[model samples]
Target: MTTAPPDSHPPAAPPSTDVEALRREVATLREESSRLRRMLDTAARIAWSHDVRAGGGEPVAPAWQAFTGQSLEAFGNQGWLTVLHPDDRAGALASWADAVAAKRSFSTRYRVRRADGVYVWMLAKGTPVLGLDGEVQEWVGTCSDIQDQCLREERAAFLARAGELFSSSLDAAATLATLANLSVSAHADWCLVDLLHEDGHFERSLVVTADPAQLPLATIVRSLSPVPRDQPVYPPSVALTTGRSTLVPEVTAPLLEAVAQDANHLATMHQVGMRSLLTVPLMARGHILGALTFIITKSGRHYGDEDLQFAQELANLAALAVDNARLLQGARDAIRLRDEFLSVASHELKTPLTPLSLKLQVLSRAVKAHPDSPLAPVIEAHVETGHRQVRRLTELMNDLLDVSRISAGTFRLQREAMDVAALVREVSARFAPRFALEHCPFTVDAPESVPGCFDKPRLAQVLDHLLDNALKYGAGTPVSLTLTADGAAARIRVRDGGIGIAPEQRSRLFERYGRAVSERHYGGLGLGLYLTRTIVEAEGGRVSLESRPGEGAEFEVMLPLQQA
Candidate 1:
């Protein structure tokens, strides 16, 4: 064999052989291209291209048949337009026209009806190709299915607006009306708000119109109850009583039969067109204030937990508004009562002051004229009684002024570091003589070195009021004053073996003008405990009480220890 030399080059292939190799390579390229085409054809989404100016060039791409289950010829010359929803057709066309006119990329989302009559949201995006001269040549695009995304966005927007409406207004009636309007607008249904009356009944206060004129007046009149709780069927009284949200779907024949016994059932059914009902209890401070009822008329749609929860939230806000309104009304009534009391008190004080002043003037002259006579003692006694009356008047005026100052946030405290034990002992000793006069046993237990920071005058005033209460209420019973301390705080407890407070009255014990029902037995303006709480709280301390009916009451004041 004539083998080539180690350094020599090999002979070149013949032209025929080279041609055959090139042919094989071209065949492989063609096979690969065919495989890629098959893959694209199998994709769910259709890929397409179009010339901007040449509108009807290639009727439909091959991929359209795979995606839509239709032949390419079916969409000849913009025939795909027929598949667009009528509501979306105009907008889609306008958008395409605008994009072509501006020579810009086009992107849009719209609903397209499939051949099977199912509508789906489609997201279409296409970019216009340009020549070197900036003239539009061809366009490339893809269509993606986005039905679920669109629905979610729509629901989210509805929820956001509903939340805004629920939080924006503080008037229950206005809020309910707004909620009704929102319900009708969002769900495209008739809405109703039935508020529970104090007498345990449901009254429709607000109605949103789907068709106001067509609403059956007789049906509404008959179906609604001024006393829903008294009825046997479709009653909302239980929900209102328990403060719960209730949903009733499609008033079945049995429910209708049960409610038919009531005269209002027919009228209510007619008025509300009630196919489904959702009842939400409006509650304030754990009590049922009312009920919010929504009636859906157009469809037999059942209210789900989500719908009930939303309604409940609205009801809760409405309940707060209702409570606020009630509080405002109560305040107005209290102001009126306070004004009347002030007028009466002013007259009473004036009546005493006139005689007191006259007596003091006469006694002063008489005492000067008969300084050594026995008549001086009689005049002096009369003078002292007049002075006591004057002092009482002064105290009433001071109490009223102090209350006003505290309410206006202008009350000032003169704070000082002092021995709390010493203060307690001094106050107790002062009250000891009073206890002796009343024949009541008194005890004081003051721990040495119990120091705290507080306003001495204010704390003394608190102690005076507490001792007064003990004397006034614990007549003929033992009263105790005890001072105790922990590392961080000091406490002074004044307890009395007096008539204790009722459980129901304890919560309002510190509220201004709050007096127990048995207050008629005690002579006071009801400002003592309120003032005490205010003074203590201002010094960064707290006052609390422990007692039960028939047992003695103990008032405990805790003050934070000031760092040395």
Candidate 2:
């Protein structure tokens, strides 16, 4: 080797310290490059750099491949442009061109096709590199996936639109129809509404965008279920009862399999290609009124919390609208009935008045003609009977007029400072004779002084109705009237030991035209308690009742006491 020529030995002669230094420098550069690559990979976005003039560049960085599942050969040399959404292509290219011409940073949001062929929103941003002469050199940019953000925005928009539609209409049918149409537009396959009846049964009120045949069969089957007369199948009823939304991912396999095995849910699911369902409760003032069911069929999409919340809001609006419509219909019906009743009542009242006036005139003439005739006593008794009948007719007319006034909001109260005790005493004295006539014992308990500001005539009317109801329904049982003062309030309670009201009917007893079935047998208009409540409330007071079937009923009136 020592004897070899310099040419053959080549670099062996330059075994110097600089060689080790160069090796160290190269190793340091390699480590730096690896560190930069890892930093880019760890970032949420994928990075790329391209020369504007060359129109050719290195393939996408490793991060780009990881994000899009595409290789360098597939994306380099403008090949990656194919992955952009068709709708976004023109805008994206225009943005890039503007950025290049202006020699400034560029940023834009557009849609890109993923490896699975699903278009997803993405944000791309880049800054231009410049040479010493200020000419553009290259563009370095990143693309960040924003699909989740875009979907959230879309969902928010859909909910806003739904709110606008539901809140604008009061027609129950139109509202339900709008809801169904919106559901369909929002990608639901079918929607149906079921309303609960007073008898605790559910009846299909509307079916939107659902198969016609399925509607009839579904309703018939639901009506025939063994659960109860007014209850729906378990899942739907549970949602209604609990006032919560229920989501069943696979209804046929898990939910329907348990209770409604023979239900045509499986066939319906196949026909509609449904895989998930949502049932939302419709409630107003804590009472379950109905339910709305939405089915997702085209795609087996699992409904999430967001979807449930949206559907629940829609159901809530629809429920309120339906409840309002029902109330309006009830009011119209009440007015119609009231008109008819008034016509009949006017005719009956005239019949009694005519005879009453004639009897009084005859009595006056007979008394003037014979001063000592034996027929005087008989005439006097007959005149007294006529007077009682006339009084009864007058009371009936007053009750009807009071009801109408209360309904029209024209009933104004005349407030006066009075002793509640004295008023109660006066009403008790007046009712004492009637109680004796009916052979019903009556008792009164009161404080020496129960001062309150109240409407005297209205209060008297209320007491009279309470006493009459107690006497009529008490079935010869003792009736007790009590008056007391409790810290800034006066309390008057009338209790009767008679057939009491059912617990279920107590809530509606004070409502207009509301009466217990037991009370209906007593043969009177159902406006007594309604008028009583209206008068009490107008005077800034409240009335409540407590009773149980076969145990007697207690009615309490509370009025604010006058300040000392």
TM-score of 2: 0.49
Tell me each candidate's TM-score.
0.47, 0.49
Q: Residue 270's C-alpha lDDT in candidate 1?
A: 55
Model 2 C-alpha lDDT per residue in residues 109-220, reported as the tens digit of each score: 9977766555678898888989998988778777777877987787678767866776687667777778777776664767767777668866666656545655664454
Top lDDT model: 2
Report clash pairs, candidate 2: 200-230, 201-230
Local distance difference test scores for all models: 0.72, 0.75
Q: Residue by residue across 1-564, what tens digits does model 1's lDDT show?
A: 898888999787689989999999999999996786555445425566686677643423565655565555667676677778888988888887898899898889887766555567888777788999999888766677787688567656766776577567656577677767776765536665666655655676765666667556634543455344443234455565566666776656556556564555654565555676777777888777766666666653566676776667666766776777666667867976775566566666667677767778877887978899978888787786677558557556556667766655678988788888888888888778779989999999887777777889788889988888788888899999888888888888988888888989987879887787566678878878889999888888899999887788999998888643
- In candidate 2 the C-alpha lDDT for residue 549 amounts to 91
Q: Worst lDDT window (10 residues) for model 2?
A: 221-230
